[model samples]
Target: MKTKLVLNFNPEASNLPITHNLIAEYGLLVNILRAEIDEIGGKMVIEVSGDDDSTNKGVEYLKKAGVGVRPFKEGVRRNDEICTHCGVCVSICPTSALILDHETRKVTFVEEKCVACGVCIDACPPRAMEILI
Candidate 1:
């Protein structure tokens, strides 16, 4: 089965030296399917697909490096009220997570398709995209 790992970085860990090593050593092995950072919140969400052992190893490494790691819940959606439907976010989404509903003519986001790249969030003019964690 595929495992999804999400890590939250504390402010101190952001500038810590071991952070780079943890990513370089462990992150390089895993699939690293998706990654996203919340600039405002100073948090990061990373998804990886692998067996339980590898996932555990990665999380252990991150913890040893002083980074906070956690498992993420699925089925998160965006708030339509703040969405402008400008369509700018659609193109920038590498995973095609966000799309314009043809019939509704409104923007829609699929949680599974999102790799948490955060590109759409950056592209969103109104900052409508949110991580439901």
Candidate 2:
């Protein structure tokens, strides 16, 4: 199973080798989408791929390690009024969530496919894609 998680690390938990343990011990593939940390602690957006049991175990492990785990629901949002549909975000979207409609020559934002990487936010010529998370 593939799970998208938002991890909150406290000051003590931030000092641990959490990612290394998740990969070596739980055997899960971890892809960090976005992260912000400091001496006090911070948050990270990560995508984990593994079997159902392993994924569940990984979450439990994070919880036991004093890290708060939550699902990632917020994603990129496009403001149609501001968007010019120039398709500038098409090539930059890592998940292909932003695409250009060949026939209509318009840009489309697929929220379900977006990983909230925030790449499109800066790549957008009109600044249409905004990361709410």
> Best TM-score goes to which candidate?
2
Residue 20 of candidate 1: its Cα lDDT? 53
Instruction: State every prediction's TM-score relative to the real structure.
Output: 0.58, 0.83
Model 2 collision count:
0
Q: Candidate 2 versus the native: TM-score? A: 0.83
Residue 43 Cα positional deviation in candidate 2, in Å, after optimal superposition = 2.2
Task: Residues 7-73, candidate 1: write the lDDT tens digits.
Answer: 6666666665443554565553344555444543245555555566756776777787677777766
**Cα-lDDT of candidate 2:** 0.88
Off by over 4 Å in 2: none
- For candidate 1, list the clashing residue pairs, or say none: none
